[model samples]
Target chain A: MMLELISRNILHRPIRTFITVVAVAVEVIMVLVVVGLTHGLVTDSAKRVEGIGADVMVQPPSASVFMAFSGAPMPIKLAGKLQELKHVRYVAPVLLQFSSSGRLDIVYGIDPQSFALVSGGFVFHEGHDLQNPDDILVDDWYAKARNLHAGNSMSILEHDFHVAGVVEHGKGARLFVQLKTLQELSGAQDKASVFFIKCDHPDDATAVTDEIQQMLPRYVVRSLKDYMSLMTSSNLPGLQIFINVMISLAVCIGFMVIFLSMYTTILERTREIGVLKSLGASKAYIVRVVLGETTLLCTVGAAVGAVASFVITHVLVHAFPTLVILIQPEWVFRAILIAIVGGLMGAAYPAWLASRRDPIESLAYE
Target chain B: MEPILETDNLWKIYHIGKVDSPALRGVSLQIMPGEFVAIMGPSGCGKSTLLHVLGGLAQATRGSVLLDGNDLSNMQDAERTQIRRCKVGFVFQRFNLLPTLDVRGNIRLAQHIYGNEFDPHRFEMTTNVLGLSHRLHHRPSELSGGEQQRVAIARAIINEPKILLADEPTGNLDTANSDAVLALLRQLHRDLGQTIMMITHNPEAAAYAGRVIHMRDGLIVDGIPA
Candidate 1:
């Protein structure tokens, strides 16, 4: 019966209840979208790193910038030395050169069989194998974006080459070409940007990475996992600070609107609360009644907001493909947490005000 | 037998700045079980304050209110709430039935608070006695002022409290509904032996009770037994 009374009370004041719910929903949506977008970006970036097919990464001495942003390249001669080491199954030399359009373009030159082994097998849609030093498979995005189909000729660093086949993979660049073609075009002969070594055993890979590091103490030799961490850690500090500020700002504003709504609801129901108390409702019971009303409003509002935000996020990403904002399960969880905590915080003052009022005074209040 | 309600040297004072306004000045009274009493006073005579003190809803500046020989002043807030839950019921002139609840739910509220199930027969009898049988499904907002007061009465007495406190129960009703409510209260008192202490300023309202206590300012001016 007490629950029934509370339910009816909330239903009776539809306008006020709805307003509070919407307020909470708006907050939840904002938090969810923020978390979703950032999480998606991190995942996509990590996948990009993984696509390079290198178990370990080697960089020139004092190369502090990561592969994604670094302009420095390891000398191409380093591949033969790394390949000669024990436990090294195959080595593919990779070079990344900036396109005239300023996009990151990668070139992989390998003995076709060795390249196939490290990068998984490649399927050519139109062109011959990578045996022709000038043939290459470009990223699907780069091909479609430049209107270049397989067998179409394109120039990278002034050297001409035919597109072997358009490819899609999580690693390497979104754009790919032959390593020799890229190097010849860029006027860098007998020197490559990086080397990817596939090891015979997973455990031996770590030992190989450590040995390579010891051999070239001046250079940085890192495993694929290490490269991923470095990439995330480098950006995490800035991203975390940015996300925290954004979330805090959203919560503060959301709380203000929600608090106003709950406070007004309480003020309007002061007499009713007095009656309940006079009839033997304890302070705890009274708080529960009020909070039950709040919970109903917030949960509904947040759910609606989440759905709306999801659609909006999809639309935005479609309209601006480069934004790369994503929505994920973890993001939704964070949104819910924020909404609930925000609802409680918003309700705190009003619940206190309701509980603190003298029953006699409230009953006598006009 | 012990009295259902008792007050010993009760004093309630309201402070405004440095001025101490006494609402009830050392008022002491005992209401025996099954007795129907009315307290009459002019505006600001502290009748309502005294009722609040005795009901454990307000604290007195000094003195103690004992309900069934248990000191209200010595009880914690939760304990007082428990006492009010099990031992007392209230009927307000404004018919403070929750507008959200229908007549049935309003009446069921008291029993539910005690975590007790409703006795449907007892509920039916109470509603029939109060002439609210047809309005059980209607919310308080849908009922007339008199009907609403009747619902409030049903809710108060549904728990079968040892003492029923009515603060001007019929003060907001028309003559016909007022008489109807008073008739119901009298019948309940006589048939079930319910103890009632009602506060009202109306002389006719006070006359229905077996005893009347009149107050002036903060002190009792007249006390008469039927």
Candidate 2:
């Protein structure tokens, strides 16, 4: 009977109830898409790091990641010194460059012979490794996107190069050329942006990393495992703050809307509450009635939000094939939990006020 | 026999800023079990205030209301509420039936609050007594004024309370429905042997009770025995 009365009360005010529910749902969508986008990027970046197959990477001391397109150039001779270390199977000096053509684009320059070592390798879908000063490699998706194939001439960095091969997708780089060619073209001769170190024994990665740090005190050398752990929500500097701000905004939106709606409802139903009190309803019972209504609204709103998120994610993945989205089950659960908790917190004040109403006075209320 | 409902020198004051206007001033009354009593007074004579105090719905400013030996004025809100739930029932002039519930649902609400399952035998008896058997499925708005009052009465008695406090139950009904409702309430008292305290300003309504207490300026001016 309490449940029925609560449902009827909400149904009695359809317009206000609809507005409140939609408000909660919108907050849920914000949580899903904003957090999911950033989380997916972190996961994809970690996967790409693992795909590189390097036991260790060396970058500028303060840089978290060696972006071939943006980082300061390090001395290329550091690769030779790293090769002299115990368990050093290969050292590949690489340059990463970024282009803002249609969107952000990544350019990788790799030493073909050294990359095929146990530390680093690229599996080609067609054609051989770089065979010309102007030869280039691309992922299958990029080749299809740019309409390039083997024997086709492609223009990059204001120079034409033969499409040497198309590598499988998700292999770290969409575009790769010889390190010497990239260095000369970019005026970065005798300097590379980063070094990939492959160890002869995979289990000795940590030892090799420690040795590299001793040799090059000015550089930051990290094992692949250490780098992947930094790919979480907190370890990244700006991402943590972004998520925190967004989640707080979502909570505030949910809490205030539910509070206002439930408070107004209690006020409107003041006489009804009084009637219940006269019939011997406990203060706890009145509180339960109000909370029940809020929880029902939140649950319905959460379902709508989950559906909206799915549709948005589907459209995004279809429209932009390269965009990564990982809507994990846990994220959906968190969104629902936040919505319900915020709603309950918002209703707490109204429920308390309702419970405290004097029955006789309320009965006389017009 | 001890009265099922009793008030001793009850006083209730309404505070408008600093002014304390007394609604019930030193009024004491009692009605024994199985009695059908009516309280009659002018609008400002505090008949309703006395009724509210008797039913444990309101606490007296300076005295005690005892229902079956339980002191309403001395009890905490929860304790007073428990007495109302277990020992008393109330009917109002407005026919305060929950609009969302049908006749059956309204009657069951009291049962639900008491955590009691429906008693088919007792439910049928009350339905027959109130003439609400055929209108059980109708919502309050769908019922006539008198029918709504019947539903209220049915809800009040569903928990089998020791006393029923009715304040102007026929005030909103037409003359015909008023007579019909009055007669039904009288018949229920006779058949169920339940105590009833009705508050009204109408002399005609007062005549139907076995006993009538007349008040003027918060004092009983007369008591007429049937």
Candidate 3:
């Protein structure tokens, strides 16, 4: 009977109920999308880096783990020193340049011969590998996203380059160019942002990494296998805080909307509350009714938000093939939990107010 | 016989801002078991206030209300509420039916509030006695004024409370509906032996009660057997 009354009361005001549900749904979506996008980007980037087939990596001193943020600060000759290390089979000097012409991208400058030794070479899908100063290699995803093909001339960083080939994705960066050409264009001549090293055996990666770190104590040296393990949001600077701030904002939105909705509902049903009290409803019973109504709204909103998140993610990924958004089951469940907690918190005061109302005054309420 | 409900020098003062307005002023009353008593008074004469105090819906400023020998005035709010839930039922002037609930839901709500197991026989008997068996599935808005009052009456008696406190149960009905509700109350008092305390301004409505108590200026001025 109590459940019937609560459900009827909620159904009695459809517009208000819908608005409140939508507010909670928006909160859920915000949390899920924010967490999903950040996690997806990080995991995807790390996987691609691991796919580059490098056993060990060496960067300039104090370099960021995010390769896109690294500058070409290390001398190109550092590749020779890494090559001379015991158990090191090959060393590839790569220059990183950030581009934001039409879209955000990180361009990798690599010496094809050395890069092929370290990365086991790109599997070309359209044309041959880099053979000219202005030749550019794009991965399959980037080509599909930008509608590019071999022999297509594309302008990047205010410079035009001939599309040499489209290769399989998951190699480090989506766009690749000649190391010398990128170095000359970026005015970082004879400079490399990082070095990718291939060891004689996969099991020797950790030893090779230790040797590189000892040679340059201040430089960032990491085995690629270990680097993949460190690709979580917490390991990335500012990402976790950003996720936290987004989640907090979403919770605040859900809380405020539910608070207002329940408060006004209590006020509107003042006489109804009086009737309930007259019928011997306890304070706890009144609180349960109010909170029950909120829980119902939040549960519905969470379901809608979860479904909407998937739909929106699908649409986004379809429109932008290069964009990665992973909606994990754990995060979806967490988002629902967050929305429900926020909604209950929002309803607390209003439920108390309803329970504390004097039966006579409530009955007389206009 | 001992009184089913008794009030000793009941006083109810309304605190309006900085002033105290006394609604019930040292008014004492009593009603025996199975008696249909009517409290007749003009507006502002505290008839409703007396009912509220007797039903344990509101506390008195200075008074003691004993329902079946329990001092409601001396009890805590929860205790009073428990008594109200178990031993008292109320019927308001406006029908006061929960608009969202159907007639059956409203009656079932009272039983649920009483925290008792469902009594299917009693529910069917009460609804049948009130002629509300057909209207049980209808919302208050769909029922007529008299039907709504009947639903309210059924709800009040479904728990078989020790006393029924009604504040102008027919005030919002037409003449025919008022007479029908009055007859129902009288039947409940005589046939079911239910104790009823009703407040009204209409002598015709008061005529249905076995006794009448008249109030003026928040105090009883006359008491006589019909």
Candidate 4:
């Protein structure tokens, strides 16, 4: 019965209710899309790292933990020296280059034989792996995104390349071409972004990583486990700050809109509030009524926002065929939860003020 | 019989800018349980102010109000609210029906807050007597002035409160609606043996009450040749 009263109060003002609902929906969408895309970047990077089949990864000391931004190049000649170390089976030099589109369009320059050896799951989805210096292997998602099929000609980073066979999704980088070709294209032919070292045995990974770190004291080397952990960064230079800023802005948007809107609604219903007080409504009851209305509005808004986010993600993937956006369901759930909490918090102060209104003054309200 | 609603020279003053305007100037009155009383006065005569003080809706500047022996002046707001919820009910001149609610909803809102299991028999008797059973599904806008007033009466008595306070219960109605509303008020008083205190400017409306108390310039003048 209280629920019905609350629902009616909200429905009493159609335009105001709709505007509030849409505002909450937009905030929720921002939460989902921002966090969803971030997760996609992290998950894709982890997959690419694991697919390399290397027991350890080595990078220039100044390079970023996030592969997409690891621009400080390591000497390509270091791979041979690393492979000569005991327990070293193969050394694959990789150049991780970020396209202007950012992380979504990262270009991986892979030494094909060494990459195939380190990677355990390299099944091709459409076309075969990189066969020539100019051939590029695109992930299935990116392939579908960009309409790049085998035998197609494309320009990546102002350098012309031929499309190799599309690989299964998550096997490796979304866009992979010959290591040498990528190196020449970047005009850094003798420098690779990092080296992935494969150990002769699985258990030799730790010892080999320690040996390599000591040998190239200037470079940073870490076991695969540590590399993967570092890859999922919570504080990546400026990226963490950017994500936090976006989230805080989204929370503030949700909170302020709800607060102001509910406050105005309470003011509009001054007489009704008085009448409710005259009817013997306790302060707690008044607060509950107001908060209940906010909760109902938020629940509906969040559901609509979730659908809107999925639609937006669909349109984006279709529009940018090479884009990798994994809209994780858990992140959508988190977004909805965040929207609900922020909205309720926003409504609290207004509810408190409404509950404190004097019944006499309210009854006399014009 | 114990007085169900009483005031001991209650005074209510309003501060307007620099001036202190007294709405009630030490007015004392009481209505015994099961009696119907009317307070009659012109605009700003302190009748509404007195009604508000008795109803625990306003604080008196001097003296105290006792509802069924509970000293309202000393009670906390929540305590006063609980008294209003359990022992008192109000019918306003404007009908004051929630616009978004249908007739039944407006009547049930009080019981919902009272948190008592609604007595269907009393609910049926009240609505049937008010002739609002058929109009229960209609919103306030859909009802006539008399019907809306009757619905307000139904809401007021739904909880069977010990005292029912009404301010200008028929002030907004036509002559016929006013008479109809007064008739319903009288009928409810007789049927339920309920105590009622109403404020009105109309003598015809005051005639329905068993006792009439007149106020002039914020003070009550009793025994005026009615």
Candidate 5:
């Protein structure tokens, strides 16, 4: 009967239900998109770091964004010094170059055999492997957009290298080249931009990174996960703040609209409630009836909002390729909880007022 | 028969700013257990106020109401509510049926007030007796004025209260419907031996009761056997 009463109340006002549902849906969609952007950046950056196959990254001391993004050309001799460490099986020097178009891309030069060891499954898509000094492997995303593939020639810092083969990697930008070739072209024969170290034991990565950082206070070292977290914190904070504000605003407005709507309903039904009271319905029972109705409205509205949010997010992601609004299972569950809490909070005072009405006065009400 | 409801010089006064007005002035009456009584009066004669005081809906300014020898005037609000829930049933002139609830729900509402479990068989029997079985699922809006009165009867009697109070039960009905409703109340009195007190202005409606008390200026001017 409680459930039945709830259903009847919701069915009583179709227009009000529609308006509340739209409000909740807009809020949910905004929150989902914001959270998705944050998660996507963090997770994607982590995957990219893992693909680079560096257990740790060493950069200039106290250099946060600039060191990672700027990748200042370091002496190629650093790899040789790092290779002398006992746990280090092989060390590959990497260079990151910025094109005249201002697009940033990664370039790594290492022995093909050792590259496979450090990069895990990273390999050329076609053409000869990186055995010769002039060979370079470009990631598929970069290759497709730049109209450069295997056998095509491209210049980095006005130094030329042949694209030996195309490669596919994690969904981040990348371009690979032989170490000696990049060193010769960039006029950094004695320098390497960054070192990609392959350790015999993956667990030894932190110890190696720490040792390198300690050895040279001028440089910084980071585990792949930390690097990803740092990247997310700096790059995605604005989107997170925006989403939080949007969801908070929606909830506040939703609470007010739903609260006022339900209150007016209770006011109109005061006589009926009084009649019920005289008939033997307790104050608590009356409260339950009112709350039951609100819950039904909010639950149905939130469910609809969830589905609408999914559709809206999918469309937006398609329109803006870089922005993906992921509605995970957890997000759906949280939205439902929010709706229930919102419904209860909205209905409480109105139900109280209705229950407190005198039976005689209520029956006397027109 | 022993009196089921008795008031000793009940007085109900209202204060409006600096003015004091009395709705009931030292009115005293006793209603027997199985009697069907009516209080008839002009507007503002305080017949309704007397009924409200008797039903515990309003407190007396200075007096005492006794139910089965227990004093109601000194009880707390919660205690009065309990008494009202368990022993007193009320019917309004407008047939105060909750519009959102169907006939069955309206009937079950009485038990809900006492936090008592609904007895389906009792509900069915009450509806059957009230001739409202066909309208059990219909909301108050769908019922005619007379049918709404019948639903009110079912709700009032569903809990098997000690007394049923009706305030102008037939005031909204036409002549034929009013007669039908009055007849139903009379039948309920006969079949269940239930006690009832009704307030109305219509002498024709009052004629159905076993006794009628006439009031003017908050005082009873006449009492007659129907």
Candidate 6:
């Protein structure tokens, strides 16, 4: 009977219910999308780096795990010293440049022969590997995103380069150019941002990494096998904080809207509450009715929000082929939980006020 | 027979800011078991206030109220509420039926508050007696004022409370509907031996009761059988 009353009360005011549901849905969407996008991006980037087939990576001193933030500070000749190590078969000197011309991207400048030895070579889908200093090779995903093909002229870092090939994706970077050309363009001549090392045996990677760390104590040396574990939000700087702030904002939105909605509902039904009280309803019963209505609203809103997140993320990934949004089931559950907790907190005060109402005064309320 | 309901020098004062205005001033009353009693007075003469206090909906400022020998005046809010749920039923002037609930739902709500499992037999008997058997599914807005009051009465007496308190139960109805409702109350009193205490100003309505108590300035000026 109480459940019936609660549901009927919610349906009594359709417009108000809809607005409150939409507010909660928006909160769920905010949390899910923000977390999904960031997690997807980080995981996708980490997978691509592991796909380079390198057993060990060596970066300049104080360089960040995020390659885009690392400038070309290491001399190209450092690759020679790395190659001389016992388990190292090849070392590819690569220059990294951050580009923000039409969109944000990272450009890799590599010496084709040595990079091929370390990465097992790019599989060309349309053309060939980087052959000229002015030639550029774009991965399949980037080519589709930018609508580029072989023989198309593309500009990067204020230099025009011919599109030499469209390679299969999942390599280190989306756009690849000759190391010397990028070096000349960025005024970092003979300087490489990082080195990708291929080991004589895959099992020797840990030893090779330790040896490299000993050789250059201040430099960042990591084995490729451990890269995936380091891709989490906590491992990345500022990413977890960004997620927290977005979730907090979503919580605030859910909380304030639910608070106002339930407050007004109680005010409008003051006489009804009085009637219930007069009918022998206890304070706990009144509280249950109010909170039950809120819980129902939030549950419906959460389901809608979860479905909307999947739909919106699908559309987004479709429109931007290069963008990846992963909607994990756990995050969806967490988003729903956050919305419900927030809504309950929002309705707490209103429920208490309703429970504390004087039955006589409430009955007399106009 | 012992009194089923009694009040001793009941006083209810309304504190408006700093000014104290008394609504019920040292009024005392009693009703025996199975009695049909009417409280008659002009507006603001403490008729409704007395009913509220007797029903445990309001605490008296300076008095003791005994419902079935239980002192309600000194009880805590929860205890009073429990007593009201188990022993007292109220019908208001506005028909105070939850508009959101249909006739059946409104009636069942009282049973639910009483913490009893659904008693289909009692529910059917109550609805059948109130002439609401066919209007069970109708919302309050969809029912006539008379039908709504019948639903309210069914709800109040669903649990067979020890005392039924009606505060102008037919105030919102027309003369025809008012007569019909008063006739139903009289029938319930005569057939089921239900204890009823009603508050009304209309002499015709008061005539349905076996006894009438008249109030002036929150004090009972006349307490006699008519």
For model 4, report the TM-score of its A chain: 0.87
Report lDDT per candidate.
0.77, 0.85, 0.92, 0.85, 0.75, 0.92
Better structure of 5 and 6 per lDDT: 6
Q: Candidate 4 residues A330-359, lDDT tens each?
A: 878888898899999999999999999999
DockQ of each: 0.69, 0.69, 0.82, 0.84, 0.49, 0.90
Candidate 2, superposed: residue stretches over 4 Å from native: A65-70, A98-102, A116-166, A175-189, B224-226
**A1-366 per-residue lDDT for model 5 (tens digits):** 566566666666778767876766665655565566666655654566667676766654455533335545576667677888878877756655444534545555555665566676565676666667766777765676677778988877566778888777562336666767766665667665566777778798888878887787788677666766666534543656766676677677667767887898888887878776666566777888888777777777777777877787778766644343456789678867776687678789998888787877887788
Compared with the true structure, what per-residue lDDT tens digits does model 2 show for residues B100-207? 778888898888887788788888889898999999998999999999999999989988899998999999999999999899889879988888999988889989
Write one digit per residue (lDDT tens) for candidate 4, span B1-226: 6778778878899999999999998888877899889989889899888888788787778898989999988888898888889998899999899999999888888889999766778778888888988988999999998898888888888998999899999999999999989988898789879899899999999999999998999999884322
Which stretches in model 4 have alpha-carbon errors above 4 Å? A101-104, A120-140, A164-171, A233-235, B224-226
Clashing residue pairs in candidate 2 are A68-A96, A68-A97, A69-A96, A69-A97, A69-A98
User: Quick one: ranking by TM-score, best first?
Assistant: 6, 3, 4, 2, 1, 5
- Tens digit of per-residue lDDT, candidate 1, span A41-85: 676667766775668767777654345344435776787888888
Give a tens-digit lDDT track for model 3, residues A1-366.
778988998899999989998999999999998899999999999999898899998988888778877888999989888889999999999999999999899999999999998899999999989999999999999999999999999999889999999999999999999999999989999999989989999999988988888889999999987788877889789999999999999999999999999999999999999999998888888999999999999999999999999999999998999999998999999999999999999999999999999999999998
lDDT per residue (tens digit) for residues B1-226 in model 1 = 7777878788899999999999988887889999999999898899888888888898778988889988998887788888888888899989888777888888988778766887899899889888989989998779988889888888888888889999999999999988888888888899999999999988888888999999988888778432
Model with the higher TM-score, candidate 5 or 6: 6
Which structure is stronger by TM-score: 3 or 4?
Answer: 3
Docking class of 3: high
Q: Which portions of model 1 miss their true places by more than 4 Å?
A: A61-66, A87-90, A93-138, A141-166, A177-193, A200-204, A225-235, A305-331, B118-121, B224-226
lDDT of 1 at B82: 85
What is the Å distance of residue B68 in model 1 from its true position? 1.5
Q: After superposition, how far is residue B6 of candidate 4 from its true place, in Å?
A: 2.4
Q: Give TM-scores of chain A for all candidates.
A: 0.75, 0.86, 0.97, 0.87, 0.70, 0.97
Candidate 4: lDDT over CA atoms? 0.85
Cα deviation of A59, candidate 5, in Å: 3.5
Q: Least accurate stretch of 10 residues (summed lDDT) in model 1 chain B?
A: B217-226
